[model samples]
Target: MAFEGGERGTTDERLTARLRTGVGERLGTSDEHDTLVGVLFCLPNLVAFSIFLLGPVLYAFYISFHEWNILANEGTWIGIQNYVAVLQPAPWANDWAPLTDPTANTFWYSLKTTVVYAIGTVPLQIYGGLAVALMLDKRVRGKKVYRAAFFMPMMLSGAASAVMWRWFLAADGIINSLLPSFLEHNWAGDPGTALMGVMLMAVWGGIGGNMIFFLAGLQNIPEELYEAARIDGATGWHRFRHVTWPNLGNTNFFVIVMAIISAFQVFGIALVFSQGGPYYATTTTVLLVYQRAFEEGAMGYGAAMAFLLFCLIFAFSYYQYKNRDQAEVGY
Candidate 1:
């Protein structure tokens, strides 16, 4: 019995040693070293993202529950009052009919304006971009120059573009100079035309980048498909409808989602041109947040509004992702 016990102990010790060897071989190899090196390389980006992006977001969320004022440099605990104020109808607005008081109802009015702005700009940007991309895809002389000209507006800083458009869209600016006398009016100074002016600038600024995406999509389509369509006597319109549009489903989806998000977050154009408007016509959520935070010194309120806008953008993106996935599956 003593001999047998000693033998069992020896076997157990050998097994333990083998297990340790296996673990060491797995964790202390060149692959492990490579992993370690990769982690070290990623550390700086992780740290930078945490410090510059995630940290600020978390801090803003924390401050959203407090009444924060930049001038005071201190915050008082408000316990979601800012959020409540942002969500609820304004005191001067009709509680049962908030839309009736655009001037006083801050959140709803801004949301409405944002939706309108998105509607006004996104489709035009997409269609205009697609049109330009299709034209550029053809064998044309000086194609590079045409592409550069179209893309020039996007290269300019948003502030610079805004400033330039402001000058051009002024009552007596270049646009008015060419228009008939009956059509001329204060483009940026009138509420009815202000949002349209902003939309025009947005469409012009965004088209070039969006066109690049479409051009890439166009290039990816197999040329043989077009040849087949031509052999079947398909017209240009039919070819675009059946061949091009079908192939560009993913690209179209991406452009639409991006355009919606960008339009929702529009600020610089409104800032330099309309300043939220002659009557808050071009006031986007971001513009409203800027006004609340910097212009009004209501940091907490601004943060709350920003969080809400983030939620909206997140929801839209998620919805689009789900729809796109389902669509791809169907296709």
Candidate 2:
């Protein structure tokens, strides 16, 4: 019996070794070799991310603490002066507030412009997108063609779209031709109308893409809810309020967050519309950053301003996320 047990133990040991070899052969690697192969596969993407994305982000933050001269490719250590200069509402404070004084800082003024631009455009995009999407959700004639027409502008490159809109909004363009003589002021030139023109372009250009998203969300909502609401004598608006709107919470949240982020990062419109102004009226944060970093060669200040804009976007997004989650939980 003892001799038989010893032979069985040896056989079992041989079987375990064979299984290990079989696995290694099938995978073309041992366990340690497999780990090395996995790492090798990931290495290229890691290297590219570090080089193209991560490196620049970290470098920007580092440069934000210094005085950077892109022309000289040099950065002097300036501590937090760039941040202070960008963030401080008043460059010189005391008895007189810059708000009422003529010597108000351009940085603060541009920041306020950016805030207003964001506030104006985001809601327009959200509500306009929803309205169009709801209309399109019904079985309308020429649905595909209409959808394509609306979405075409979103597919165009920013420069191309801006150029197209510039022509349309030109002094003697189609829009002016269609409008009455008294109403046809220089849309992109007058400070009073420049920002409004850009905002209108932004809303029109953005709505189609957002509408598609909302359309998808609307389709995903169960039809039974609408049917049940109808059975209970709910009116069109009542059905929409209780069923459609509630079901669209997630979609609304996504659209709102993206809209806010895009609005805050507006540069192309401001650049092409008024070139950041008919007296700096349409200058956005991104346009200001571009002017500072590239045109003015104040890289540090631009980086600081860019970072501040990022913070504002992040905070708003966080607030939206928290509220969305709470609403979902309550529901």
Candidate 3:
């Protein structure tokens, strides 16, 4: 009986030791198991974004508060001087002679121009696109051909399309040639017409793309909704009012957001056609940034302009999103 009891004690000790060893083995490898998977999952993307997108964005912000040629001059940190130079609402601030010196007023003018561009172009794109989309939503004859024609400008590269538009708006070009000699004027070289020309071109470039999105949204509205509306004596306009507009909430939101963003960063077309020309009549904030940094080699100041534009766009986008979300919730 005593030997049996001693044997039982040894057995219990051995079982406990084995259990501890097993648990310890798992615990030792547990960190490796978790960490290995994490590294494997996130390693590639983390490195890529840090090197490419995130790195440049961070670097741009750092460059914003400095005075430097940046690349060749090795920037000096002037702190908020750059911001002050940009946000001041003084009349004499736009003296762009000191290309390196971005005054608060010059920045304000650029901001004003950007706001005007956004206000003008976004509504044109959104409303015009929606109208075109409504026109094209039916089973009309040769609809595909009409759709392709409308979308052609959007399909072309911005530089190429802008060049085409510039030529068309130039004196003695297609637009003026079609008109009588009395009406002929160099649209791209006249301050009165240059900005308007650019805005028209922008609507042409953007409306089709917005229309495509709206078309998709229209198609997504369940046909049964329209059928139900018609049964309730909701004829043509009424059907559209009850079934179409309300159903288009999401599409309208997308188009407005995209249009505003595109309008704010409208640089490529400006570069190709206007170059902010006709005596700075068409110079946008982004174009001004390019002129400062790359053209004038005031890289630090140019980076500052870019940062300011980014902040404006961020604020605008946030406002639009919040407003749209509230509207949808109200619906």
Candidate 4:
């Protein structure tokens, strides 16, 4: 009986070794198989990005050096003439002051308008979002409803939002009705108020999205930190200053960068709301690009401007990313 038991134990040990060997063989090949699967999964997205985004960007760069006629679907090599035309003053200009003689340089005028729009909208959007986020973060009745209401505007398409705002700011619209007779004016028509009208629409439509971002940042703050602050006899303001704000550094950086980029590329609101305006007051760089490219059939020149705009955006984004430590919160 002892001899039989020893033989059975040896057989079981052999089976276990075989099982281990099988598992090892399967594990050795699994990594390569998983990598192949991952590549297959990502293949479609890579192809789509190449075709839709990367392809056009490269093509635009090529077109920028040529005199491309959109109607003819052809181009003639012009070297840097398109860029020179965009930068040089108009033939009729008496001086080189682009800012003072904005009309003498279409690119400068549009760039100034774009900068003004950015200045007008970026801060208000960021702070207003933070404020709304704070208010909604509190324990209050109907918080979800308020959140939905605020976020609803963000879900609207840019064209839809522009159309809606255009009506609201019309001569006989709701906004005008609220004002006294003498104070009321054509918000989208008058040159003085046209850009302001666009800015107002931009801020209103933008705040809700920014608020959502701020709310997410606010919620991510650890509760333990707040409790600790309170235990240390910290007031609400003190807690926010030292704990809350510091912890929200990453969120703040993201919000600020996105806001600046969005401001620089603003097009739909200015296009649909003011139509780039009364006396070109709202003619932003992007709008000018569109007008030059399609409307006026200066495709190459427009491509040059578009490439410059891309470079400008890249420079700004790079600067912010390089200075990220300045915005970081040390915990």
Off by over 4 Å in 3: 1-47, 90-104, 326-331
lDDT at residue 76 of model 2 (Cα atoms): 96
Candidate 4's error at 300, in angstroms? Answer: 0.4
Task: List model 2 lDDT by residue over 3-26, tens digit each.
Answer: 444687799899999999898998
TM-score, candidate 2, is 0.81
RMSD of each: 11.1, 10.2, 13.1, 10.0
What does the lDDT read for residue 270 in candidate 2? Answer: 79
lDDT, candidate 1, residue 220?
88
Each candidate's clash count: 0, 0, 4, 0
Lowest-sum lDDT 10-residue window in model 4:
91-100
What is the alpha-carbon lDDT of model 4 when measured against the actual structure?
Answer: 0.87
Candidate 2: segments with Cα more than 4 A from true spot: 1-50, 89-103, 327-331
TM-scores for every predicted model: 0.83, 0.81, 0.80, 0.86
Better of 2 and 4 by lDDT: 4
lDDT of 3 by residue, 59-169 (tens): 888888788764675788898887776655454554643232233355556556667777778888888888889999998899999899889888899899889999999
- The residue pairs in collision within model 2 are none
Model 1 lDDT on a 0 to 1 scale: 0.87
Ranking of all predicted structures according to TM-score, beginning with the best and ending with the worst: 4, 1, 2, 3
lDDT of 1 by residue, 185-286 (tens): 889788878888888889889999999999999998888888989999999999999889988999999999999989988888888887887778878789
